[model samples]
Target: MTLPWETLTGEPRTVELYLTTPAGLALSRSMFNSAVWKPAIRATGIPDDRHNGMHVLRHTYASVLLDAGESIKALSAYLGHADPGFTLRTYTHLLPASEDRTRRAIDKALSEDQAGDDVPPSLDGLDTA
Candidate 1:
């Protein structure tokens, strides 16, 4: 699966990240050095802080997606999680408070069915002793 960052780049190059250098096509951990990361961050007008970095952006994306009511299963697939359980455990707060609503709906349907079963028929002055 393609990474979200690759999609956001909006450019097709033979190399994935930096592209065409002695250091190969793909990005590496060393590519995130203070010189490379800090300047790019500064250019973006985001503050230079210890906690505010690329990883923080990833976490923000995950949290936002969860809060937006996306399904845990979908999120797990998106995040490449081995199991959906991790997604559920991480974002349990996003679950809907609909237990009461579900129960009420079921009860209402059952009540309607019971009422229909008791329907009475009208007779036009026809009686037999």
Candidate 2:
């Protein structure tokens, strides 16, 4: 993805592989450190002394996906986690609600089946004296 832009040198040029605004410009470490991170942290209302950063966004993304029933293996791959076990260990706290939902789904299915079993089989075109 190349876009026309002016470099800091004031030379007109095109940049590639950039996603953030000022479209063609890629994020520089200095830009992140000085411009982006502090403002985002302030906006989030997290104390500056506490832990908060892009990693928090990553964890939140994983947690939301897990709560929505996305597979752990898939999430691990998405997160670039080397092993599914690490992903599971990291996010195990998010799984219990999913397990409860699974249990409820299974119980509903079994109850529906039991209700069906209570119905007599249809007798069509039969004669009774």
Candidate 3:
């Protein structure tokens, strides 16, 4: 029931982690890239570059969280980064663009507010003035 991992020597081992071959060996990057990643991305007609590789999946995950207003600290933990600052440095560019935030802020500011609403502030507010 655990994620399978294989060492460079093709030794199967269990970690407190995340893939594996049908033989229960954790799928290696090379194996996955050749057997799965390459074919899938190629089918999608992407340029077949590293940017569209498996690494992009991590960025896509981070981007989703950031777009959803997840904090850097929270995203850092999810990304298993040692520090939130590293997460910021690595993924800050993926954050919602300032103009998008500005548009949302203005829309929100211009909207009528209902009294006695207990709505909590969204993290999107952090990205804007």
Candidate 4:
């Protein structure tokens, strides 16, 4: 779907097309390579020898989704991967520090239990000791 800011005359742009020049002409691969991508890389001051491509953007998107608590299966589907296992294998390192967060949560719960008055309702009948 065309975003409100993407149209000049307020008419929705076609969904099938992604890249277009300022004049509304479809941006060709050659135009993107020479006119857009190269200039962006040069502006960043990254060495020409370093890895640079549209795939880097895809990786960033996957990492952001994983860090935001999106399930691996859902990310896999969004990324068009055939298997969730592939997504897990590719993005395991990018996942958030859930182990640290879990530890902190448990510590808080135990401290609240010790305080007596703040014990969670779910742990009320359990032997917290």
Candidate closer to the true structure by lDDT (higher is better), 1 or 4:
4
Measured with C-alpha atoms, the lDDT of residue 119 in candidate 4 is: 55
lDDT of 3 at 96: 85
User: Candidate 2: where is the Cα deviation over 4 Å?
Assistant: 1-23, 28-34, 43-45, 117-129
Range of the 10 consecutive residues with the lowest summed lDDT in candidate 1: 120-129
lDDT of 4 by residue, 1-129 (tens): 454443366756546566888887778877887788878888998754436765677799999998888999999999989899999999998998888989998887677668875554574533644
Q: How many residue pairs clash per model?
A: 0, 0, 2, 0
* Model 1 CA deviation exceeding 4 Å by range: 1-24, 33-35, 42-47, 93-129
State the number of backbone clashes in model 4.
0
By lDDT rank, best first, the candidates go 3, 4, 2, 1
What is the alpha-carbon lDDT of model 1 when measured against the actual structure? Answer: 0.66
Per-candidate Cα RMSD to the true structure, in Å, reads: 12.0, 11.0, 7.9, 6.6
Best by lDDT: 3
Instruction: Mark the regions of model 3 whose C-alpha exceeds 4 Å error after superposition.
Output: 1-18, 97-129
Model 4 worst lDDT run, 10 consecutive residues: 1-10
User: Any runs in candidate 4 off by more than 4 Å, and if so which?
Assistant: 1-18, 21-35, 117-120, 123-129
Taking all chains together, each candidate's TM-score versus the true structure is 0.46, 0.60, 0.60, 0.61
The candidate, 2 or 3, that scores higher on TM-score is: 2
Clashing pairs in 1: none
- Whole-model alpha-carbon lDDT for candidate 2: 0.72
